[model samples]
Every structure is written in structure tokens, then in C-alpha cells.
Target chain A: MNLMMLLEMASQGFADRGAVQNGDQRLSYAELFSAAGGAAGIAREAGVEKLAVLDVSSLAVPVGLFGAAWSGKPFVPLNYRLTDAELESLASQIAPSLLVTSRDRVGSLSKLPDTQVMERDEFLERALGAETPTADWSMDPDEIAILLFTSGTTGAPKAAVLRHKHLVAYILGSVEFAGAAEEDAALVSVPPYHVAGMSAICSSVYAGRRIVQLPSFDPDEWLRLAREEGVSNAFVVPTMLSRIVDSIGEGAEAGLPGLRAVSYGGGKMPLPVIARAMRAFPDTNFTNAYGLTETSSTITVLGPEDHRVAAASDDEAVRRRLTSVGQALPTVEIEIRDENGAKLGPGERGEIYVRGEQVSGEYLGRGSSVLNDGFFPTRDAGSMDAEGYLFIEGRADDVIVRGGENMSPGEIEDVLLEHPAVADAGVVGVPDEEWGEAVAAAVVLKDGQDASSQDLQVWVRERLRSSRTPQRIEFRGELPYNETGKLLRRVLRTELAS
Target chain B: MGQLKAGSRLRSAVCDTEVMVVAAPAAEVELSCGGAAMLEIAAARSGDGAPAPDAAEGTQLGKRYVNEAGDLEILCTKPGQGSLGVAGALLTVKEAKPLPASD
Candidate 1:
């Protein structure tokens, strides 16, 4: 049940295959396994309870991840983008930890009490020089494998615990062992702290796909690396994909012929942007993956075929599925439930609930939130169509209750995006004296395009009911998006309310 | 025989085959590999007993074996010279329906 088992199997199955690469540096499966073993030795010698990485994506991520597993400790990857005080607070919580960071930050991080900060290079060198530890990872499924601090847009962050069994089941259920070709390379640009980043490492390793890391995301740089490294697959947040598409621009050649598949998730993707991307990379398979950190990774995927079918279909319902997150994975069961916990029928708006072996609804201090029947309330307002396509609206808290009718901002936003002039849009519920709330929108126009707020209102009114039209439309340069591509609806709501 | 549950690791005493339960029936059943009774990893006896001639087909690493009833399923953690079976009925390799790689 240990995560090391996946890496060990990969090393045994394809020891000579490339496992990880950063810039010009690369590590084969055999070398990565050896490094993990060595790192485990260092962790055991330091007697640290946990191994934490505060640096960007690098060789340290995989080494630290598998190393922690081999050492039987929960691996914690903190957001390096956090402010100094914020990072310090989190580091202190995991005291007596082996903190791995870049060389420049080592001096400052080393000052923390009960912490040992080592530069990434020094840690790797020492690990390479140290003796490899014996294979002694526990097989207990209850053992904690990772502690991911959920990116709370509203409150203080909490660590979401992922056990060995949960993660192993996720990988085993979704990805086949050695399924990838030896030539397949997956370009990963997400930060190591995110669940997608960690899952990419494990999934690529077990699937025998070589990982090419991008320390920071830049659309041009992503394209350059994809071409230079023969990257056949990649996982990007919607923001990254938007930028990549913009970089490709109109009528420009997307020189990445080797790119076969690209999966976008971590946020709600704007329809126009995805449509543009499909044209930009005509040969590449596009997937819209939807999940949360609590679900290990992606529980449902709008796969490649659906993307093409939806884009080409003339039917409104069929084309509308382009915005849906598609059906649940074979291992997962998804249900839309009312506030009373009753399962809702198709096309009924309610809370999204999921049940699966990979779903870990337990927080660090908070006990398990999973219901007695094993369903985990996702807190996301969404609905399912008759064919089982799941349409995710904004978070339940973001639902705009205007005169007691629950209205989904995503519905309004989608209509606005269909406008030819709109490039980006964010819809929120603003407090109103007359009604309980009113629908407000902030939109970014496409470059060189012009559209009045009246025109946009009519655009929605024509497609949807008059009540669904935006009461307040503010033209903006851009919508606020978090680093991971989630729209800051709370920020917009606050600004509009004031 | 003990009731098989998920996460249970079993090894064939008669051969080198080892498996981890992926899915199992709720009720206790006679599970055997290579025509010999399977023992839990913790209680497995160290032996290299020969496999029955009728069930000598070897197991493959990373492959899943399932019973005809679609209830009992085990993932081969280690390949061995003996095949997996239950109640003298040979298990078949479960074909994997490959999903698109989505991280």
C-alpha cells in the first residue's frame, strides 16, 4: 500500500527509462529509485517526523515524495509562493521537519526552531552519497502518505490527509502500470504544492512516462519546452491554457506536433478559450478534468472524444456539454443531492456528492466528514443530465439567491462568454435592498473588441430569461484568478457588494 | 478460511505467486492458487511446493485475475510460475479498460 511500491514497480519494470527531467538534467528510473532510497536514509538519520518541500518544481520533489514514503512519513509540500510569515507559520506547524528549499532561502528557513533546512543541491548530493536504506516501508493502508494544505479562498488553510490506500487506489484504478510508451513525456508546469503536481509525478512514474518539469509557467516557455523535449502529454490549469492559446494567437502555427494529449483542470475553463485551444492544437487530444484536493485528483474527466463531439455538434445540448465536466470515472459514483441529503434527479440543481475509495474527506484536526453511507459532500453546486454529464456550477456558497430562487452564476457567465466580444467573465451575487441578492458580472473583452454593458445584458436576456440577465455589468481589463486558475468570486462579490 | 477483504495480501504456499485483494465477496470462500490453499502474507509458510499440472499456467506481474462470478478479484503483486484460482476454478486475466491519462 506504500507509495514507494509504485516507484519500486516502475524501477523494476523499466529501470532504464527516463523517470524525471528538469531543464537539461534527467534521472532514469533506476537512478530515481536509488536516490529515493538514499533520501530515506537521510530522513531516518535526521529523525524527522515529516519531510517538507518549500521550493518550486525540481528533482527534489520526486526524491522528497518517494523518500518520505520510503521513510514512512507524510510528505508536506508547502506553497513556495506564500509570504514569508505565512510560510513560516505552516513550517512551524510541522516542526522537527526536514525542510528542502532553494539555496538562497536556506539561511532564513534554517532559523526556525526544530527545523533543518538544506539547500536542494546539498540535499541531493548528500542523498546520492549516503547508503540506500533497506526496503522497510509499512504496508498499513491507514498510514498517511501526504498532507496537502487546501488552498482556502475564504478561511485559514487546513491540511487534507491522503492515506496510502486512497492514493494507491486512485492510481491503480485510473492509470495502468507501464501503460505509457517509453517515448512518452509529460510536461508538468504546476507547482509542487498542488495535488495535480503530486499526482502527476506518481501517475507518470507508474505509467512509465518521463516527466519534464517547468519551474514556472510561461506560455511561450511551455511551448518551447514541449517542442524541445518532444513532450507528448501535459497537464495545465485553465489559466495556463488560456495564456498558451493567446500566445499561439490567430493563424499562428502551433509548432508542437509531438504533443498528443493535453488535460486542463484546477478551475472552470472559459468556453471560448477552450474552443480556441482546440483549434490551436488541432492534432492534440484535449481533456477537461474535474476534481478537488480531497478526491486525490481527477474523479471525472471530459475526455478527448467528448471534446471533439461537443465542439462539432450543432445541437445546443450537445455543444453545451463542452462546459460540463463529463461522467464519473468507473471507480467513482457521483450523485446530486438536495439540502436535505436526498438524491436529486437529473437536471436538478443540488450539491454534488461523490463516493469512491480515493475520496478522503478527513481534515487534519477535523474528523471524517464522509457520511455513514460513504458519500462525501463536495459543497459544489452542480447537476447531472439524463446522459450522466455533470455540470458544475460555482461553489454552493456562491449561489446567488435572488428573491428566494437559487441562481447559478456559472449559467449567467456561460451566456456572457458566448458573446463574441467577451473573452473572460466572472459572475457574482451582490447584496441588494430590494431582493436578497442581485446578479452582477465583471467581464474582460477580447482584444480590439468593443461591447457596451447594455449589449451584453441583451445578449444574456436573448438566450436566457430576463431575470437571469446581469443587473450590474462592469467592464474590466481582466477577472481575478488565483495562482491555480480558480476565479476569485469572493473577491468580486466583496468588491461589488461594497 | 477467513473472509477476504480489500487490502488483504495473500501468498500461495505452493508457488511463488502473491496477490493483493482488489475486490472480494463478503462471505468467506475457499481461495486457492495453483490448486493449493492461499495463506495470508503474515501467516504464509516458506515453501516451494510444486503447482498442480492442470493449473500450472503462470501469473504475470501487474495483471488482475478475477473469478467468473465477477466478485473475487486480485492484483498480481509478483509474478509466479503458478496461476491463480478459487475452488479449483482457474481465474482469468482481467482486461484493463485504459482511460485517457488525466492527472
Candidate 2:
């Protein structure tokens, strides 16, 4: 019913096993248990209702995570890559909070009201040194456990609220307790703010797998850590996998010796990239996990055998399973439904709707997104074959998610419109090998006005972050629009691609 | 005893075995361990009685026990010398999970 229960059980099952490690700093299961108790005590005495970590992945990530659960306060992991102003805006939303962050960010972040900023090193030191409280964490399933800020296709970000029961169900349904051997280590290279990072901690803890943290992901460094740590499990995004394949050669000597499993999601994995990777590391098992932030972590997974069978089969139907996300979990039910809220049969592409105990389709202020029929509309377009294999097409909406981060097209276009020489603009996601998709825009110039693509790119880069800046900008007479005045993004995408 | 919801946690009164309800039947049924009624996890365990001959099959850690009707499923978090039972029938462990951990 609680995240602490997973840690408690792991501590009892294997007290001496390593729970977390970061550069010669390690905590055994018993040590992590005690440190979580200490973290709870610190938060309780500080009188904060929530514990938010603004720093990168480190030992404090797990401590703050389990510690907040023990303290009965929601743990909030903020994205550290945001600008200072954006970071403060989100900090204000979760005010009256204990903010764990780096040293340089403390002064400006502490200026906010009711926000107590503790440096990362100091926070870890105090959390590790405080008096350990007894294991008396609340078992109420409805208690809020984590608050992850996800930017929808809207103005501001919404806090995706994950309750204890939602996460517990996901873990218990998918992961077996203490199923990992003592020597099994999981390489956690994703950012702590990501959904994958949060779920990795819970799954690894319950499985009694050692966690090796990597704050910044580099292909060489990742492989080095994996080789040195004897890592058996790993999860990466498609962009990371492609780059990792690009770094190493295709031979046994280049393979990660002990890596048994490698799972990827967050973007489509090209067949050539994975094919090259499988040849590079012949012993590794590749899985493609597909899920949304609202549905906990992974609701459907293409297992290892499916990858092999799909790659080896000459039949097109069986080989197409390589791109499918496979079937739903044993405890989950998935359906494809049209816009009329009616269910569609197999081989029909519609919005992906899922129903399960693990799906927490609720935001902080907004009401539950789950429909009356108990199905949560995933807002993703996908179809399933007759055998229940799910294939993802793309986002149902026009939200441009580049490199796993959501970028608002309207916001970018609005900035381009601010240019005095620009009359109108339309932004859409174009296919790219890395980052899954790149931001591209088509623009129409004002009468008797002259401006180059470089001029507009700099204008937007100053207004927005570089990541949101359009990679490709094309000048045309006008952008395509329908009779109802809705921008025809699909037509623009095809026009730009050709 | 609390309602047998999916996330409900229960413990065997005669042994250290603990389980969480995964799939519950529509109707409340007698769920027992070691021939004795399983108590809520918060309840104190006596650890005095031995497993009956018919229910002596020990439970395994990280295994799912299900009844014949497939309406009730429980996951064992801790192992002990107690067999899971529902309505006087011994539960069987589900063997060979079809999928591996995705994360």
C-alpha cells in the first residue's frame, strides 16, 4: 500500500545487498532503510508537507523519494534542466516545501516564500546523519506519493499526481519481489524527474536489484559504468540507444559483458538501430516498453522473445511485431476507441484507452481523466493486430515532443509571429533519426518584408529555449488551413518532408 | 478483516507469510492460511499453531496463489510454512509468467 513497504521488505529480504551506488558512495538495503527513516525524521521536523528535489540524479534521489513516503509527504522531483524563472514558477506551485538542490541554485530559489532550500550535499549529509525514526509509515493507499510536473499541450505544466496504490499496483503486477539475485545491478541513467527514473527506483528496490546512478548520460560513460558495475539491467530512451550503438563496433569485444536486458521507450526505435545494436551485443535482450506518465510507467511491453522472433521470421506479419509494443500486462485491459467513445475492433487505429489499478489519470487541480467506463484515454493513436500486439502511430494531438520533452507549437509560433517581418507561422513535428522528431515551421512573410531563416531562428531562441527553437524553417506564400480555420498540420508535414 | 480489495495486505497468524490481494471475488469468502483465518497485516501474529496436514504445502516467496474459479489471486511477499486456502480449498501457485520486467 505504500512505497516504504517495498523498501522495508527489501531490507528484510537482503540486508547486506547494495541498494544504491554513486561514485564509491553506496548504501546497502539495511542502510537505505535506515537512511529513509532518517529522511522522514528530517522532513517531519522541518514541518514541510512535501519534499522536492531540484538537483540531478544522486544518492539524494532515492533518499528523498523513500524518505518522503515515510514522512507521509508527497515527493516532488522537479526538472533541473529548466531555466531559473521556470524553476521558480514550479517551486511556487509546491510551496511550503523542502527543496533539495545544488549549491549554486540555493540563493535564488530560497527567495520564494515558504520554500526552504537545502544544498544537495548538506541535505544528503543531514539525511544520512539524522536520527532514524521507527518504521511507522502510513499504509493508506490513497495518500499522494509523487508529484511529477508534465507539460501538456497547454499554457502551464500540470502536476501528475501518483498515489501510493497506483504505484504499488504497477510494481506488484509487473515485478516479482526479491526475484533478482544478489549480484544483479540495474543501471539508472535517466533523469530523476522522468517517470522512468521514479519507477526504476521502486522496481529495483522491490526486486532487490542494486541501483547505479548516472546523472548525465554519455554513451562511453554509460558503457564504462555498466562494465565496471556488472550491470545486468538497463533502461534507455531510443535516442540514447541509437547513440550508444553509434559509439561501439559490431563485435563481441565491444559488447557489455554482463548486460542481460536492455529496454527502451519514450520514442520510436528504428529497426536499423536496434538491428545494429543486437549484432553488437549478441547476449543482450531488447524490450520495447510503451506507457504514458498517467499510466504509471510501462503498461505494455514487447518482451525479449518477441524481438528475436520478429527479427528472424520471414513472414511480414510476424516480423512487424518488432515495432509493436506487444500486449498489455496480465492485470491491465487495453482498448482502442473512436472519438464517439465507442470501442473499435482489432486492426483499427484509434485513441489508446487503458484501464487498470495502476493507471492514475488524475492531475493536481483538474478532475480525473478516466471516463465513466473506467478507461483512461491515452490521447495516443495506435492499433493492435489480431494477436494483441500494439503499434504506436503518433500523438493524437499536435503536441511536438522532441527528445522526450513536450514542446508547445503554439508557443513557438507565437514567438515567430512577434517578428515584424513575419505574417503567419505554422509549427509541426518532422521525423528525425535522433530525438524522434524535430521542430519544423513553415512561414509566410509580410508584404515587402525580407528576413532570412537565421534571423527568425535567433529571434525565437532568445524568446524560448534552444530546444524549442525550430530546426527547419521554410518560407512559402501561405500555410495550409482547412475550411474551419484549423491549421492543417498533416498537410504541412507532408509538404515539408517532400 | 478489511474488504478484500486489490491492494489489501494480509498476514498469516500462524506464520510469517504475508500476501496482497490481487484479484478478489465478487462475494466475500473465507480466506485462510495454515488452517487459520488470515488476519489483517496490522494484527499481531500468535505463531503458535502448526500447519494442518491437508494445508502443509509451504508457500513460496514472490509467487501468485489462485483459486480454481480464477476470481481470487494473492501474491506472497514473505515465505513461511503456511499454505494459502480459500473456502477450505488449497490455492495453487501460478507457474511460468509469460513476460519479463519491462523497467
Candidate 3:
């Protein structure tokens, strides 16, 4: 049966439970399915052959997404923050038959092509007003369902086509990882435009658990929602985690009692923040997930038990193991390869490649970035431990060569984060005439706590060798992170150069 | 309580100006004015819709200002300005006298 049936089964299974919540709005499984089915009819009516959905993270997006998929049209969600010029360029390429946008975003579409635009009001009038369609679970497993775009290092975005099978795998994997039960509720703050956000929404829907949708990220709002909604699970990034820790300070008193599971990924979670979170919320299970859009959100998860063992121990072995991303999840495989396409051994740093049923062979629309071997080269520099745990050193693009010494900026950032005054930090290699590139750091300090550049420099020197320490430290009110909470080190490099 | 009418219209006079307000709760409202020289609109009172200030709210006149464009000038309350004399309603362009047909 197709995914449409999954929703029907979930609705029947959890008819009485809350399926989705946004602010004061709530929709049960039955309500959500009915709404989705009705919306599907509206999408069919709108002639959305290949739907381009501009979604703000909300309960409405998933409902609309189901409708789009059921109607057998690929739903392409565009990042809402993109400039008008960028939107127009993408619109010209996609040439969507129907554009789904909120009323607030209607004005932004002035430059777009004259497609049939369905604003929020129009969506409600057509979708909610129509009768709920019957659940027959139409479409093939191989059929493309969603097209996700990756912001390229060169500036342009590449669209990754995700099929129904990949989505199914991602949802199933997350369910197993989180051990989602009907009693559980997931609070997702990630925007629906990204793979992580969309995957979380779909997984919660499939699990028939309650999902609390946060329209945007706000630390205080997140804490309040977790408590108020009694959220059991959440997917967060390290940056957001740092903010939450800062807002709550250190310990269980500032903890979320109902939050049983908290998964973080996107960028590397600093050891310090991970430790502090463990100490503060001893009852909560923290999981570190590693994946990309090409792999349908996550392929590996370092579970709570691993985090506890690592954080509790001062032993070098334990701390070293903590640096590694956990072993591949069920049905996922990883391989490290050098430039000549030769497989690298354990402890050898190279490009991290992954293969699985969840992992797409090639991107959907424009094809994937994967090579002929069916392994999507993650462009992440990493080494696999003898235990088979993946230890990511840095992005292939994040390498720093200072006086012929190759360095990973992630290493310096990790060391800097250990400092008490540094709340968040990112290191980038700045061009240097002598060293070819010099290590530079941009940091955000803990609230009301200021650290001089020399303070950070001395602190780093105490921990790492002089070569690994950042030669320059720049204090920032905030570090630049994308919607996915991934540090834009490329931006930091440019900032330092300027 | 009696079933609320599908639509309701109210007319209130402020400083000798009788303004007819159309209220369509939870629905979009469209109002057309008669014989006014120009029209001005106040942005939504609250980001989330909150009811307009009531009479007992002491007729707090918020800032009064005028929007001037070519051939039209509109006077209304500025943000956070609430006053009884506040012109929070719309105005229409006064009809021009019919121009005599040229030979």
C-alpha cells in the first residue's frame, strides 16, 4: 500500500489522540487525514501537476503535503527566506503549475510567473470546504514525492528529488530510533522547507503521535511549548541547544520534565554543550543524528546510552569515542574513500559515503550528487573507527592549511567551545601570505559574560597545540547559522577576510 | 441567544461624520464609502486580531496624523494613538462636478 494508507491507519489507530498542534490550533489524526484528503481534492482542482509549496513550519504544511502526494504530484518546498531574485530564478526552472503561499508571502510572488496562486485563505476555502477523499493509497513506491534543494557552496541551490520509498525509510528509521509511541508528542522547531523539518513532521505523522509545530525558533517559546504541550520528543540543532541551555542555565530545575528524547545534529554538537545538557536534563535521552538531505535526513544516530557513557567518563578512550558519530543505523552502510576512489581503512580520513534503501541512488529532478557506485559522497571529511563508528573531522571545504599543517576548523571550534565564556563558536581559515591560511575564530559569548580575544587565545593554547589554536579571535553578538542550524563557515571566512 | 446574523452593519457618527462599518466576523469584510474626498486605512489594531477599543476605554485618542499624496490627504490616528476624535475610519474621494462637454 502507498503512504496514503499509512495516514489512514495512523488516524484509525490514534483517532482519539492529538495528531498535530500549532499554537492554539490542534488536529487529531482523523481531523488531519480528513483535512489532508479534502486539501488533496483542492490541489487536484487547482491543477497542481507539480506543486511548489512555500511553507512556513506549521501543521498546515504536512496536511497540504499529504494532499499533494496523494494527488500524485511532487511537492517542492522552497526556502521562504530566499530573495525575490532567487525565487524567480527557481520558479523559471521549476515552472510550477500552482504556487502555494501564505497571505503574508503573497506580495513576494509579484516577480514569479503567472501560475495559479493558492494563498492561505484560498487553501482553506477550497481544501477545508471540499469533502474528504477516500483513502486508496494511490501512487507507486518508486514515484517521486518531494523535491528538496541543497544550498550549494558555489551559491546556487541544487534540487534533490526524494521518492516515496526514501521518505518511508526515513520515517521508519526515526520511529525506531526515537521508539515513538502513541503517547508521545514531538515538538519540531525546524522550518518545513528543510529535510530535517519535513522528515520530523512525516515521522510523527506516521507514528500517530502528537506533534507540536513551532512557526519559528525561539528559545523561551520552545521551553514553554515543551512544558505546555507536554512534548515527549524533539529534534534540535546544536546552536538551538546551546541557546536553550543558556536560557535555562545549568541543571534539572531549568529542564523539561516531559522531554524524554532530544535529538541533535545539523552541525557538530560541542562536547561542552552536550555534557551540560546531559547534566541539566539527566532524565532526558540525548541522541546525535548524522545525515544530509541526500540521505533522507539521517543514516546514523549516537543513542542516549552512548552519550551518557561518554559524558560521564573523563577517560581518554570514552572521550575519544564520543567524537565519533555512532555506527550506521539498521539498513545503512558507510564507506570512506580517497580521491582515487580507493576505499580507506579505519582511522584514515577521507570523504564519507553512504548507501541504504533510505539513501537515494541519485537526486530526483537533476539527479543526485552520488557517484556510479551508488554511494552519495557526503563531502564530509571523516574516519571510521575500528568499532565502525563514523568520526567526522570536518567538511571537505573546511580544511585549513597553515604553514603546510592541515587543520580541521571543527577541531579549533570544539576546543574554543570548552571555554566557560564561549557559548557558541566557529573557526575558519583566513588567507595568509605566509601560512597560506591562518586559523581564525568567530565566537558568541555567554550572556553578560565577556572574554577578551587574548582570553580565548590563551584558553585555546592551554588545551591544543599552538598550530591548532586560532591565531585571531573575533567576538560576535551571534554566529551565523542557517535555518538548519548549520554554521556557515564559508560566511565566517569571508567575514574574517573583510 | 439568537443566531448571529450572517452579516451585520453598524453606523457610528464621530465629529458629525457618519461612518457605516460592516462587520463580518471571522470573514473578510469589504466596505465602500459614499461621497468622501479621500480614503485612509489604519493597519490592523493588533498583530493578532483584538477587538477595537471600547467606549469605556476612555476614548484614548492615539496619535493623529495625515497621509498626503497627490490630490488626496487623509487624516487618522498614528500607531499607539487612541483618542475619541481619532479618525480610524475610511474616507472617499469627493465626486468632482461633471465637466461640461467640449465642443
At residue A357, what lDDT does model 1 achieve?
A: 96
lDDT of 2 by residue, A150-219 (tens): 7333347788989999999898888878889889999998888888899999999999999999888998
Q: Which ten residues in a row are the worst by lDDT in model 3 chain B?
A: B58-67
User: Which CAPRI quality tier does the interface of model 2 achieve?
Assistant: medium
TM-score of chain B of 2: 0.90
Best-fitting candidate, scored by DockQ: 1
Better of 1 and 2 by DockQ: 1
Model 1, A130-179: lDDT tens per residue? 77777788888899999999888768888899999999999989999889
Q: What is the lDDT of residue A390 in candidate 2?
A: 94
Candidate 2 residue lDDT tens string, B1-103: 4358877789998877898787898787778998889998889987578878788788887788999998899988788888999878999987646467677
- Measured by lDDT, the strongest candidate is 1
Q: Which tens-of-lDDT digit does each residue in A351-445 have in candidate 3?
A: 88898767874654556666777788888988887778888877877888899987777777777877888888889899988889999999989
* Better lDDT candidate (1, 3): 1
Q: Which candidate order results from sorting by TM-score in descending order?
A: 1, 2, 3
lDDT of 2 at A38: 88
lDDT of 3 by residue, B1-103 (tens): 1111221211122221112121123333232222112122221222322223441122111111121222222111111212222223433332222211000
